[model samples]
Target: MSHARRLQRELQKMHQDVPVPGITMVNTENFTQWQMDIEVLDQNPIYHGKTFRLNFKFTENYPIEAPEVMFVRAIDREIPMHPHIYSNGVICLDLLSSGNGWSPVQSVESVCMSIQSMLTGNTKNERPRGDEQFVLGAGRSPRHIRFVYDDPTV
Candidate 1:
């Protein structure tokens, strides 16, 4: 099957697996990108009672090359504050990372779900532990950053 087709199938599986309320790509013309909404379900320190948009852009070399994911909106403030996420809502998940372990078998839906899982277990409203500077500098573009989670104490 083509890469697009495989991605679609993977998305379908993700929609089925995700328990949170969100939409999946069901359009015909644009299978490369997906749009959805995610919110702070659990009552945590911050990000409570807030909703954020989720955007996933699959490339022709998806799985092998991580999809371009981001959060875009007028008043969006629910960006994932992970060690790898940028300020513009672009995530720095492992699968999306370059030499870390990117493969061609991943799917758009799975990627989204992975993000959801990452957000599901959090209680902080701040960016990754100590990436305030990078977040301010990194724009929405695909920033090339090899995450160094050296702070095992975190």
Candidate 2:
């Protein structure tokens, strides 16, 4: 199916199903770009009372290729602090990497839950090493950057 059709089906399912706790679909008007707000459901002190915004940009190649996903800072929203999350909102999760861990079966909701789990399990209250340099030199899309997912334990 075309990417647009697939997205439409996903959107319909999202509206029909009981919403996942701590995960809200903020914007889905555009199939090319969507936004979601995710909160760590657990009592992770570092992320308590915080909601992070995620921006997903889907390409025509969509499920065949992973959509570009990243944290976005907006009014009243700040990026969550995690060792794998950069200061600029670029994430270093293997699941977001097309070559490393992405699969055709993954959907927007699944990605949000995975990210929520990532934040919930994280105890470190800091950005990845060299965050400044990486953010300063990073390109507009996370797909262009080569992130080394060396540490499995966040």
TM-score per candidate, in order? Answer: 0.69, 0.97
Q: Return the lDDT, model 1, position 3.
A: 56
- Across residues 3-88, which tens digit of lDDT does each residue of candidate 2 receive? 99999999999999999999999999987999999998888899999999999999999988999999999997998899999988
Q: Which stretches of candidate 1 lie above 4 Å from their native place?
A: 11-29, 74-84, 129-132, 152-154
lDDT of 2 at 1: 45
lDDT by residue (70-154, candidate 1, tens digit) is 7756465456565445566666566676675566666555565676666666554556654667667675365366566564332
Q: List the residue pairs that clash in candidate 2.
A: none
- Could you say which candidate leads in TM-score? 2
Q: What is the lDDT of candidate 2?
A: 0.91
What lDDT would each prediction earn against the true structure? Answer: 0.61, 0.91
- Give the range where candidate 2 is weakest over 10 consecutive residues by summed lDDT: 144-153
Q: What value does the lDDT take at residue 84 in candidate 2? A: 95
